[model samples]
Target: MKNLLYLVLFLLAFSACNRKASDASYSWASDLHQRLLTDFCLTEAQVKDYIRRYLPDVTDEQMRQWEESGALECMMLDGEKRYFRNAGPNLFRIDSLCREVKLAKEGEQVSTSDRANAENLPEILAATDGRGDSCLAAPKRMRVTYTLTVDTNAVPAGEVVRCWLPYPRTDIPRQQDVKLIATSEPSYTLTSEGTTHSTLYMEKRAVSGEPTVFSETFEYTSYGEWHDIRPSDVLPYDTTTELYRRYTSERDRHIVFSPRLRQLADNLTEGEDNPYLKACRIFRWVNDHFPWASAREYSTIDNIPEYVLDNRHGDCGQVTLLFVTLCRIAGIPAHFQSGFMMQPRAWNLHDWAEVYFEGIGWVPVDQSFGLAPYAEKAGKPYFYLGGIDSWRMVVNQDYGMPLVPEKKYPRSETVDFQRGEVEWTGGNLYFTEWGYHMDIEYLNY
Candidate 1:
């Protein structure tokens, strides 16, 4: 009996240790800090091979030089040197020589659809000219089928898999006439109106060898907006108002006005007084400084604006956050806005900013698109500053907002909601365990 008692204690202690070990393993995968390093999975050889695609004659010395200059982003993870997943492509975007070689190889061949989209910007600007109240123009009807599929055996068979897909927000003026045509599931929960990260929640039971799929078909009319403002006519913000207080104040992590950021803002707007002009200065600075590059997962990033500042290059969302942060620092009310830039055949996930002009209300600003080269040549250098193209699907009004019904686990994308998210009763399904695809059809207006 005494031996039995000892055996019971031994078993209890062993089980406890195993549980602790399992928890630690799960924490390493799910913990935000540890997950940050997961995206930096490339090796030195892989980076070199990728770079050679752009510059076949590139040498080891040149690679070393670029790495030393921080053009090739890398980190030491778990005692192994790893390069950022996008580091190779980012090299071409950041390094002058690499860019020259890349451009030379690509030449000046713009697709018909791309050229049309580019030309459409000035047309939108021209159409909206002199019509202050008619900011919305060139509306396009679109039907989108967004699908999220969990890998076979991702969850135990017969267990229910919960998924939250991004549904367009109807509160925006430009995006209107949103209609849900159908969903894969018969019954689903569409979040209450004004949920920051608007979502359509659905669930499905997993099969032993079949993937669990959640999909929705929705249609909406998106309008392009252009704000023509004369600096002299711009009015001062009512600092006492909620709009001013909320947008101008810093948000945690991403939007904080660190000393470096403050100094940079001060330098950029050294002599500028008007809020509109100040925002323009900040916008142009970010556009000029940070060229677009593929980005790591937003969830892993703690402070996006700071990351851009440190790296000197970022993707659409990254640069937008930087611009928004700078605008806030300069006392211009700015906030983050993002969704798919549904530009016909060229649609993809895109992010931009919206600045609150006291008299004009909130106008769209896309620093990623920056000043269109053609627009700049046409004397409308600030086209994207106070204007936006119509092919947009606004999903989230603000970043990092909670989803409806609330997700039980950490979000697959904690910052942005365009890709959609998934989980089960067991835990959150990371991007690896699941995949998402968006199919868009542009319908005639």
Candidate 2:
């Protein structure tokens, strides 16, 4: 009976001391301290000493107050046996701790020294991690189903999958709208079992180049949206503009505004006087002048005028970026557009650009398709803008994404291969020639 009483007294004393620690005056430290104690069974002295040992610059008084009730979150890890605290908005206490321990931490710090250290820590860690020479661990593969229904039973196998529908990674938004034509079936198979489809993954080894062709057509309202006018209608033309300066400084006088192109402009005056036509003419020039070469990177271009100067090669994406850059310099509004190019051999993703002209509004101009022969074949004086090949499916209408979902892998660039996060390289495969297959059904095709 006496031993039980003594035990109760000990617990009472500990509770009193802790209650004082959690007082409102020191709530910032106390709350977090108590949480840590509950999580990791840490003593107040141990917590204080840990904080002090790591963050010695933090005054003992500040540390004491923080221990009692300052702002910090003590989270229990290791099946609730270990406590962990993280740096929150008020990170001064933690920063002091980090400094004493010589540990680097993140967050905007008032002290520039911490900020400087934080910047280089990632590179150091990445180097250390890379040295371990571990290959990227592949995620668990799960089987998913997609059911595709066509509106008509008798469609050409060649026509079922449009040119631009993303196959392997089908998680891109509005993919079904473009890729899946009107189908007569009620239910479709899909890998993701959610209201909205998740990004899909395909292994390079699984696809054996066997064409999974479906033949059918269906009726549905087109989900395509027109480009905005007004501000979206005008291109940047300020001589002081960076784009204008980049072009003018690099381009030779003869090619800057070529007399031949100017004459070609004169020949087509009926609708050619329009800015849209002028932009098309420029796109034609860029397409014809440069050969399609995948050697250059999509991210950076060394010389804007060099392609025209040397009559050299560039890729679809490069020319698209160049055309947009030149159009912006010429004061014609332009923007980049990208999506899958519907082709049989499983082409990599494609990119094109749009120019907003006053009368014709926004028109699609993809020069990489080689417009001259196509125009001649079609018996048209000029190639069509705003008109796209039925072989393509546009997954996105805008560039430099602002509406991507959370936890996106690969974080999209100006152009993407599949609609979702993917990293595949047989070590040397370029963007233009890769293949994939898909099988999905739709309702009311």
Candidate 3:
């Protein structure tokens, strides 16, 4: 009887373990949710009050229903109620909740673009040269500088502050003539460590009460490139090769495949055979489908691709990641390349993917830009698939890879690396604690 009981208990435990593995529910989700309730709780009244104060149209009845259903939870950070753009996770039918509450409350669709498309876009298209096989355009080269600064008063006094500022990638072909002109603190600067993402490291000790600043001034010539690719010319890469196998496989947390995703891919590419054609189909579907919305921090979301599909709206990183995942699912190689994008008189951090065509090499694909109202013209629609504007400042070749020195605390942005990361002996500094600035001057060589 004792032996039989032991076998039963062991079998039950094994089944539970298998169940978790089968579903691919992140182990961290439950714990993070619990923290939301226990450590980060805001009382029901507090939530209602906040809504009344900021969102006057939201009703007591509607708010009450959402709370009772566990679809809404107020996030508290540093003893203050912090607002995240979306409800972290819906305990019920999240997709439905988003459509009714989030979208309905807004009264219109999400913002696709706040500005016109690049003014020089016509020139880019005009510059394209069909060199026998593919279209190639050379973006005018310019020297540019980037700077990132942090406030000393934000962090506690007497602790040492270390920062990792993103440096322009030298490995890629487009940018060249790299130069490091200066740093705020000259004595403690480090550069060019061998890592997938390049960084210019700098550090300074907090002086009783003073701001800490870090900056890197560099010049690199920029070029725009596109290869006119045909499906027949894109020969299949050797999938058995280790590099192909690694990139083609699922990545942790953000890039997993599920039944829903597979079904969506299958539905989109029902009759498509060529990988490039399949990619084009998925790209068009995503661009037409999703709109841009303020997103919850990447740390709070699990599967970005699935999240985009569920919400029907996502920011640049979210949409680009979705495109990349779908392409990989179709057996085409794709990865992330992102940093800052510069337009005349404007600059903002951005994310986009690069797809590998056997004959054409890796090509840029910005579904967010391609889908925007501005790029909806002849030839411009397909420009991002292979041709990216020279305005792009490519910093990362891939996402979720570690920094050269490694981070002591969980990163400020867990999914993508940008801006920079900072920390001291006490703990990791949040984005609320510091700010960064970049000054770009167009230089003629």
Candidate 4:
């Protein structure tokens, strides 16, 4: 009887262990749920108050109507309703009525520097007019200090905290003259040039009541590139080449081609046989169809492009991915490129795409910038289609790439790597537990 009882208890224990193993595989799902809640933390009352700033006469019924029409996004959590963190500001950008009201209240104002920047594209096109395959010009040099700080008590005192901050890539043509000036820590490990997501790794022991900070100062030169691509001049891609096969092929997660994606690709590139023209059609479609809006955390999103298609809106990275996926589906070789857009006085994290033309090689395409209104008026409607400005810092040549000194815990940001990552013996420190800041100083032009 005793032997039989022991066998039964052992079997039950084995089953419990197996269940835990199965649950461990889906740990990300649990983490994602928490992230979603953080993103959608705004309460319904808070959102209403926010909208009232622009639409002073907004009524409860109207708010309901907007929510029902999907003009405003919300989710039910913890048995109570919650709205997206940016739902209020995004309302002015997304909804037609709100946009008009906001525009009326605050007239459309473009800064003088921004206007001049827009006007510079034509100059670049003219300067690089006869230079075949030599698109780089107008180099701007700048120094940048990037810092990441983990809140006090994020991890227990005396525990070691590891950090990975964005470092400029030395291999790119447009970005050059890379030099690391200094770092907060005396000892640091800078990843090799080959790392897809270039990073500078450092560590410090957490203090009892103080934030753990990591920083680096560096300088690099960025050049404006304008590819005078003539659709007729583009040669047929050597489909058998490794470059053609690799970029044109489907990637996992964000770049997958689903049934709807395939149909959308065909519809966008319906009659185009030329790869450049096909890419143009797809790019125009995404820019026209999906307007930019504030986005949720990327780590919570499983498939980015599909989310954009469903929501009818996306931020910079989201729209770029949609454009990339569509281009790949249309048999064009496209890849992801991202970093910071370092336009003076207006620097922020940004993402864009790169497409390969058979003989022309790869050219930059910023879907978010799209066709600037001024550029359109200047007869340079597709300026961003094959041109980029000098105000950029290319840190990551590709997205979702691994960091050096491999992280033991899952990254706070799994998709993008602009903001540095932090982890300790306890676990990963998410955006809520830490913060990042970047300061740019223009060295020369």
Candidate 5:
């Protein structure tokens, strides 16, 4: 009887251990959710509010689906009530949430905004190109010209004339390679980095015939400052010694903005607690360290140190994420924010980072605004960090998935940019593909 009892007891113990392991597998989700709720006291009804404020229209179902799809690996909510995620993980997570909640507001559908004025179009009288008759016989060199007329009364108050050279059209609509190579005026600035950047992004709508086409031949020259920073120069995670407990802790692979970020505090000597200085250094490091590239799409990569070491490049979202991560690791509190960079006649989506100084609360930082170096070289305008450009317009306040009480739908694994903005009345003018064309025109008399 004693031997039999021992065997039964051992079996029960084994079963309990197995169940614990299974729970651990999915515990990441519950851990994240519980932590956020406990700290923020976020209620079920407040889920939509948090989602709308931070993440836009992302639904609870869409976020789950995205998580299941392996898009977002993890998510973290900060002390300031803001949620964050890595690139791939966050994308899928949002998609899942959208699917789960039937009424989950994914984002405010901006379809009823003002329509793009059809009358405010550039008049193209004719476009002509000089090239050999046949493809083979075509001259190695090509010159193209366009004649345009401007609407006197339709001009935007602060608008300046920019150029859009033609690019070869292709079947792939999502391709970003299509751009204007030539313009009526020298509206673009060439950087030493070999990237031809233009502050003026043009949106074109055909008023008459199909847009003209052109090709490339030789290189154009522009005297501009260029930089070739390597992975080591920008990624300095291994260089710091202030914080290691957060990273080395054996509790769980996932962590919030505690020891990991708080570690950065050690690096500062005594008065380094000044939030303003910390923010400045963090901004400089991000802008200087991470090269601008849309390398990682919408998935999550929150571990800034790991991300900078593994991938030398990241876009605005990742860069801002890294900035926030480092700030948290260093003990400073930070959050994520996003919006559109609004120009005179157009709007482009933009994202930036925010940090809480002891007295200031939350301040904004955007490294993707060409950083300080990129700005100095261009010689056209302002520096990033501390000062944000007037062009920036905030739309979403959250980072990761929306807060959902129950799993309504699967979350999206990838982040998506809604092409057009509309209001309640339907101001949808989003083209499946965007194009630009500009010609030198005299002001209408």
Candidate 6:
């Protein structure tokens, strides 16, 4: 049984680490464990009661048998035994294993229906019908609402607070018809073109016991694009150009190229001369080999490409970095783009890559979404390679760029800027201290 397997592994780890299974470890762990769970809208008492119902089988005496089992790794922090976040839904699962753990008291699964996907079928059919380059609505019209709110009373009263919200740039071809609906409170200024990340900058005087909020409602066109890419039509960009050199070169820790990554890129594109063909090969290789897994905090990893190469798994951002780095090494002009993936049910923070070719300038590719599992079903296997679907909110043009009106304290998240950021004369407000919300509505026009 899977439970028995975890028990054995935990026993081995316990013995190797020489851990203590005393009540002191689990007791403090119980308190801090539920303390963090409150963020999920569950109270300490409710969590304890849930444990009683869900894990009636686990007992203090039995846990002592393999007390060092990894359910909750207990250690002495400041002379008190505490447990770290473990691999279970609630704190009880490590000691008492359960394949399914429900968050609320009710066992029902809450779900949402997806909005209908707008298609370019008419265009695709038109292109094939007339023998023209395959096309779709290059970009369709969309209206979006993005907001960032810092918790009330988070900073001292009257201190100058600064914040930046990701703003879509009309400069990108796939994005156009940019308009600002409104900005909350004291006015905002868009980040200058010179800044790497495209964001709206705003500041306000902290009001005593009042939440600081910033919001923008805007409309733009997003396209479901597909280029009928032909090897012969695809010409390489001149290597001498600064744009080509800049994109092909590495930037920051996430996009670095080490010997292993360089060699991996070499292997992935072996026997491939066509840039388009080479990109597809590397894209397929990374997708199939790396799979997908929940990632640890991004800040913890030193180099994303090296990490994926070594670990064989990563989330969207992590995998995108790997795919981007490998593509650049293969002599393709690949770069980063991240914002929100606006699904009908719910939008989420997401990242993807874009590469430039001669005939076609910039094309979007989502490595995590990968080649469609059954491309024939949609008549598109190289779909993501040359184009992307219509549902996307592109905010940050590049990652790891400095913020306009930089912060005095360390940024809570240093990697990608999806959720807005906040700071005051006192200090920076981490995600924990603030919250963000995004909503999108389509305009018929």
Candidate 3: Cα lDDT at 244 = 75
- Candidate 6, residues 42-145: lDDT per residue as tens digits? 33334334456656555655443433443322334454444333322423322223324433444644332122233443334334421133444635577778
What would the TM-scores of all predictions be?
0.91, 0.37, 0.76, 0.91, 0.34, 0.73
Error of 6 at 330 (Å): 1.4
TM-score: model 6 vs. ground truth: 0.73
Residue range 1-445, candidate 5, lDDT tens digits: 9999999999999867865664455444554354343333433335445445545666678556543443332333543433232333233233434324423545432221112211111010011111121101101111213223333322233333222222222221111122344543333332121111112223222233333222121111111111111122222233234333332222211124445345543443235544455555666656665555433324333454445434545666667666666666665555555644433345455667554443223335576664543244433222344334333334334444321121122222123221211111111111212232222221120
lDDT scores of the candidates, listed in order: 0.84, 0.39, 0.69, 0.86, 0.37, 0.68
Clashing residue pair totals per candidate (backbone < 3 A): 1, 47, 3, 0, 93, 4
Best by lDDT: 4
Per-residue lDDT of candidate 2, residues 240-314 (tens digit): 755345433323321244444334434433344345545666767776656554322221223434443332444
Residue 252 miss distance in model 5 (angstroms)? 12
Residue lDDT tens for model 1, 41-132: 88988998988887777788987788787688887878988898889989998887788888999876565445655766766877777246
Question: In candidate 3, where is summed lDDT lowest over 10 consecutive residues?
Answer: 86-95
Error of 1 at 72 (Å): 0.8
Off by over 4 Å in 3: 1-116, 130-145, 187-194
Write candidate 4's Cα lDDT for 193-296 as tens digits: 77788899999999999999999999999888987677896898889989888998888789999999999999988887999899889888888878778998
Residue runs of model 1 more than 4 Å from their true location after superposition: 1-38, 109-114, 377-379
Ranking by lDDT: 4, 1, 3, 6, 2, 5
CA-only RMSD, every prediction: 4.9, 26.0, 11.7, 6.2, 26.4, 14.9
Residue 135 lDDT in candidate 1: 77
**Which stretches in model 6 have alpha-carbon errors above 4 Å?**
1-139
> Which segments of candidate 4 are over 4 A away from where they belong?
1-26, 111-113, 119-123
- Candidate 2 off by > 4 Å: 1-273, 295-311, 343-348, 400-403, 406-419, 423-445
**Candidate 4 structure lDDT:** 0.86
